[model samples]
Target chain A: MLEVLAERFNYAVIIVLMMVGLYAVIATGNLVKRLVGLSIFQTSVFLLYISVSKVFGGAPPIFDYKDLAYDKLDPNAIYSNPLPHVLILTAIVVGVATLSVGLALVVRIREAYGSIEDDTLAEADYSLELEKGV
Target chain B: MSASDITQYFDYIFMAMLLCIGIAVIRLRNLFAVVMLTGAYSLISAAWFVSLDAVDVGFTEAAVGAGISTVLLLGAMLLTSREADKTSLGRHAAAAVVTIAAGAGLFYALGDMPVYGDAASPANTGVGMEYVDLTAEQIVIPNVVTAVLASYRGFDTMGEVFVVFAAGLGVALLIGLGGSKREED
Candidate 1:
C-alpha cells in the first residue's frame, strides 16, 4: 500500500497540503495565519511540479566529462524532465515577491483597524461608509 | 494487478481527489480557507497535467495556481472580511451548485480528448515534432521544457509577467498607498 501510495504520492501530498492550507484559511481569523495558509498552499504546488518532473529511472540532467568512471550518455536512459524545475524556480521568486507585498498590506490593515478580526474591520468599514453616504 | 494496471487506475484516483478538493474549496466558509483550498485544487490539476506529460504546462500551472494566486487572494481577503452575513449562505449555495453542474458538464463534454501522448496529438505530429527533434541541437539547453517555455513561449511568458504586475498594481490601488490614515469624523 505504501508503494502504491508512493506511485501517486505526489498528487496525494499536493491534495492534502492544499486541504490543510484551505482549512487554515477557512478556520483562522488571524490575517497572518491566513497568509501563512496561503503560503503553504502555494508551496504544495511547487512540490507538485518538482514531483512531476521525475521520470521512472531518470538521472539528473548534468553532463560532466571529467570523470573517466562515468559512461557516455545512454540513448535509452530515462532523464527526468528538468523544465519543471526551472519553471518552479521562477515561480518561487514570484511567490516571495507577492508574499512580501501582501504582508506589507496586512501591516497597514492592522494599523488602520487596531485589530485583524474580520468582523471588527467590517464594522469599522461599514461605519465609515455610512458616514460618507456613498 | 500488473504495473500497467496500476498506472491505469491512477487516473481515477486523481480525478476523485480533484473533485473532493474542489468541493471543499467551495463549501468551506472561511475566505482564507477557501483560497487555500483553491490552491489545493490547482495543485491537483497540475498533477493531472503531469500525468498527461505536458510537463511544461504543468509547471506553469502549479506555480501560478498555487503560489501567486494564493498570495493575491489572501491580500484581497486581508482588506475585507472573512465572516460574511449568515443570510448570504443561501445565495452562495446556489452559486456553488451552479458551478459544480457547469464544471461536470464541461468535463463530460471533453470525452473525446486524445489520450496522453497519442501519436495524433498536435504536439506529437506536427511542427512540435520538429521542436522535439531539433531542441538538443538548436537550443543546446538540454531540457526541452526550458527550451519551449523560455524560447518558444517567450512571448506568452512576457504576457504572464505583465498580468502579475497588473494584479499587484490593482491590489495596491484597492488597499491604498503609503498607508494613509483616514481622520475620524
Candidate 2:
C-alpha cells in the first residue's frame, strides 16, 4: 500500500509546494515576498517535470561497457529522460533575465515613489492622474 | 479499490484540487494574492502536464509559472495596490465564468487524443518513425525531444529568442535604461 501511495509522490510534493507558494504570493503585500512565492511555485513545477522524465527500467543514456552483461540486457536499468533537463536549463536562463528586468522595474518604481507599498504608490499615481484630468 | 484504482482516484483528486485553486486565485480580494494564486494555478497545470507525459512542457511551465512570473508580478505590485476594486468583483466573476466555459468547450472539441504509448499514434507511425529510428545516424543525439526542439524546430526557437529580446527592449523603453537622470525642468 505504501508503494502504491508513493507511486507518484513527486506530483503530490509539487502540488503542495505550488499551493504554499501561491498562498504566499496572495497573502503577502510586500513586493519581495511575492517574488519568493513565485520562485517556490516555479520550483515545484520544475521538480514535477524532472520527475516525470524518469523512465522506469531504462538505462541512463550514458554508456558503460562494464555494466553490459554478456547474455541478455539487464531489465533493471533505468535511464532518465534528458530532454526535460535541457529545456529546464534554458528556462533557468530565461528566469534570470526576467528577474533582472523585474528588479530594474522595482528600482525605477522606488525612484518615482518615495514608498514601495502598493497603496502609497496608487495614491501618488492617482494624484498625478488627477492632475492630468483623467 | 485495488492499488491501481486508488491511484486513479488520486488523479481525480489532484484535478479537483487544481480547479479549487483556480477558483481561489480568481476570487481572492487582494491583487498580490491573486498573482500568487496564478502561480499556483500554473504549478498545478504543470503537474497535470507531467501526468500527460509532456515532460518538456512541464519544465517550461514550472519555470515560467513559478519563478519569473511571480517576480515580475511582485515588482508590478509594488507600483500598484493590492486591494481589489470592490465594485469590480461582479464583472470579474462574469469574465471568469465566460473564460471557463470557453476553455471547457475547447477541451471537449479536442477529445480524440491518442492514448499514451499507442503504437499507431501519429508520433509513432508517421515521419516521427523515421526521425526516431534514424536518431543514431541523423542527429547522433539520444534524446528525440532535444533533436525535435533544437534542430527540427530550430526556427521556432529563434522566434522565441526574438520575442524575449523585444520584450526586454520594450521594458527598457518604458523605464528608460541606464541610471535615471532627474529631468531638468
Best candidate, lDDT-wise? 1
Can you give the TM-score per candidate against the true fold?
0.51, 0.54
Q: Give candidate 2's whole-model lDDT.
A: 0.54
Q: What share of the true interface contacts does each candidate keep?
A: 0.02, 0.04
The residue pairs in collision within model 1 are: A25-B32, A25-B33, A26-B33
TM-score of chain A in every predicted structure:
0.82, 0.77
Model 2 clash pairs are A26-B33, A42-B66, A58-A77, A58-A78, A58-A79, A59-A79, A60-A79
Go through the candidates in order and give each one's DockQ: 0.09, 0.10
Instruction: At residue A133, give the lDDT of candidate 2.
Output: 100
Model 1 TM-score (2 dp): 0.51
What's the CA error at residue A82 for candidate 1, in Å? Answer: 11
Candidate 2 on A24-133: residue-level lDDT in tens?
A: 45544445445545655565556555544544333333324343323233444334454555555455555545655655666567677855556667799999999999
**What interface RMSD does each of the candidate structures achieve?**
8.4, 8.4
Lowest-scoring 10 consecutive residues by lDDT in candidate 2 chain A? A63-72
lDDT of 1 by residue, B44-78 (tens): 66676565454565666678767776666776666
Q: What's the DockQ of model 2?
A: 0.10
